[model samples]
Target: MRLLQVVESAATGVGRHVMDLSGGLLERGDEVVLAYADWRMDRMFAEGLARLEPKGLKAIKLPFSREIGPEDLRSIRALRDLIRTHGPFDAVHGHSSKGGAVARVAARTVPRRLYTPHAYITMAPTIGVRKFRLYRALERYLARLGTGTVCVSHHEKAHAVGTLGIPAPTVHVVHNGVAGPARGDRESIRAELGVQEGDVAFGFVGRLWTQKNPLLAVDAFARLRAVHPEARLLMVGTGDLEDAIRARGVPGVELLGERNGPQTMHAFDAFVLPSDYEGFPYVTLEAMATGVPVISTETGAIGEAVRDGVDGFLVPPGDATALSGAMARLMADPALRARMGASARERAGSFTIDGMVEKIRTLYAG
Candidate 1:
């Protein structure tokens, strides 16, 4: 089948999702064209798309703004023109809000119009009621234009049907998947990050943004060090919170900005993500695939992946005490970490990129 994938903000999890999904489709003998937002494109995504281009993936750029603005109409027109020039794609799948909005409107004539809201804006814990209502209304309206809404987690599907009032039948949950991490030199990576032997290195791999709650990770790590002083936090991403995080002057915290998240997983004994909310983070899956257990907040569909005490630990959002306690549990017990890490690796097998792509293919066929 021929497919057009549209996405705004080709960075982080969304970028990884587009890159993986499009590449997977191409490998399966499908013609795929990606319309991405160049305005918000990141180097990682640009390079990934370039790599995929040689493998029969076609990528185009559209003027998609991060916010709802006057440029949406122009974006919509651009997608419409692409559809006309490309001629009759079997399905048009949009990722995230801005891309979904424009793609749904522009692909009204297409037989299958699908959307994936990695995480709805209304899911933010601190969202204002007025803004929430507006987005909810918009989402409810736009959802009807598409044949189906693909949610990365059940929590997001609940929000769509329960809060946003989208129909139950139209919303489907397809957990994000990964192809495991490429092998990296564990000793070399740890030595480079200054994580000495006998130190339990906890890694955080996401944008230093409010949603990621990087500060929470720092606070939890600090609390863990009071009892387990040998604990180290290797942060591997940069964003708005970089300066704020650095300002705290926390000891044993290495701010290794913007590295290959999966490759860097080799250096970590455990992966930490204290996100305020998430649909189903790709990093979490990648971490699990690397045989490292996760310590994450009980938000979004994390509970679906990290089986609490089984594969990893889950604490309530913003709870430093609980987060620290979980980290301490993993730090103090090498046997426990090994056991959980093995379970994490075994569980990671359930979320293969092939499984996700096949589900999506079935959705498009339906």
Candidate 2:
């Protein structure tokens, strides 16, 4: 099968998903091509690509922009030309908003196409009501053109059908997957981070965006400090809100920005994400895979991944008190955290890269 994955920015979760899915497809004897817009501003893209390219995958750079303008039309035309040159791909899977628009438009001249909105633009709190409605209308228009829409979470599928008025039948939920950690020397990582053997290390991993609500996590940690003074917070990944998160002045918070591979999973005792919204964050899955008890907001499909009081705890979105309480519970009880962490690892095993790849292959074949 000839598959083309179109994505705007090769930066975060969506970029990583494109690389992982494409690489998995190739490993399964499918020919895959990943075409993404250049991310000149994001150093992480260059760094991530350095690791991804060596995995026997082909990546194409294309011009793409978030704003719809004259240059964007030119980009669409250029994308059309790329599709024409690499004609009749078995499937064209699109990721992100700009990529979805370009791919769906280009697919009109092609055969089969699928779009996976990593997180719909309309769902972003930063988008105004008028613009959000307009984006939803546009997405509805695009949904009519594609073969099918793949949502990362059930909550996302619900929004696609309920909020955006997309037909329920057209949407499919395939949660993000991650490879389990390689049984890293956690004590060694803790030692390097100057954390003692008995100190509980709380971690959060993701971009420092408003939607991630890193500041809320800081506030939650601040509350947790009262109960468990020795608890430390380790944050992974960088974003525009880095300074703001740092400015929160929360004690024992270590910001280890932009780590990839094994280092990403190591140096954590538990994982917490207080995202305001999401389309099934990969960080939560990755954390669970690393045997870390997760405490996250009930954003998008995260609730499906975590069984509250079983694998992890789920607080309401933007509820600092609830988040802080959950963290405190885990921090104060080592046995409970360990049991929940083990269950989280077991839950994550069901969402392996091979399982996700096979599901996509089946979808493509269907």
Candidate 1 C-alpha lDDT tens digits along 159-269: 999999999999999988988777899999888787788998999998899989999999888878777779999998888999988898887888999778899998889
Model 1 score (lDDT) = 0.90
Q: Tens digits of per-residue lDDT for model 2 on 1-366?
A: 888888886776777788778878887888777778885325556665676577755677888877877777877787788778875688888888888888888778656778899878777767898998888889999998998888888888888898899899889888788877756777787887789878888888787888788999999898888677799988887888899878888878889887663454667777888899877877788888888888999877888889999998999999999998998888888899889989998999988888888887777776
Query: Residue 213 of candidate 1: its Cα lDDT?
Result: 95
Best by lDDT: 1
Residue pairs of candidate 1 with colliding backbone atoms: none
Sequence-dependent TM-score of model 1: 0.96
List runs of model 2 lying over 4 Å from the truth.
40-56, 245-248, 260-264
Write down the TM-score of every candidate. Answer: 0.96, 0.92
Scored by CA lDDT, what does every candidate get?
0.90, 0.82
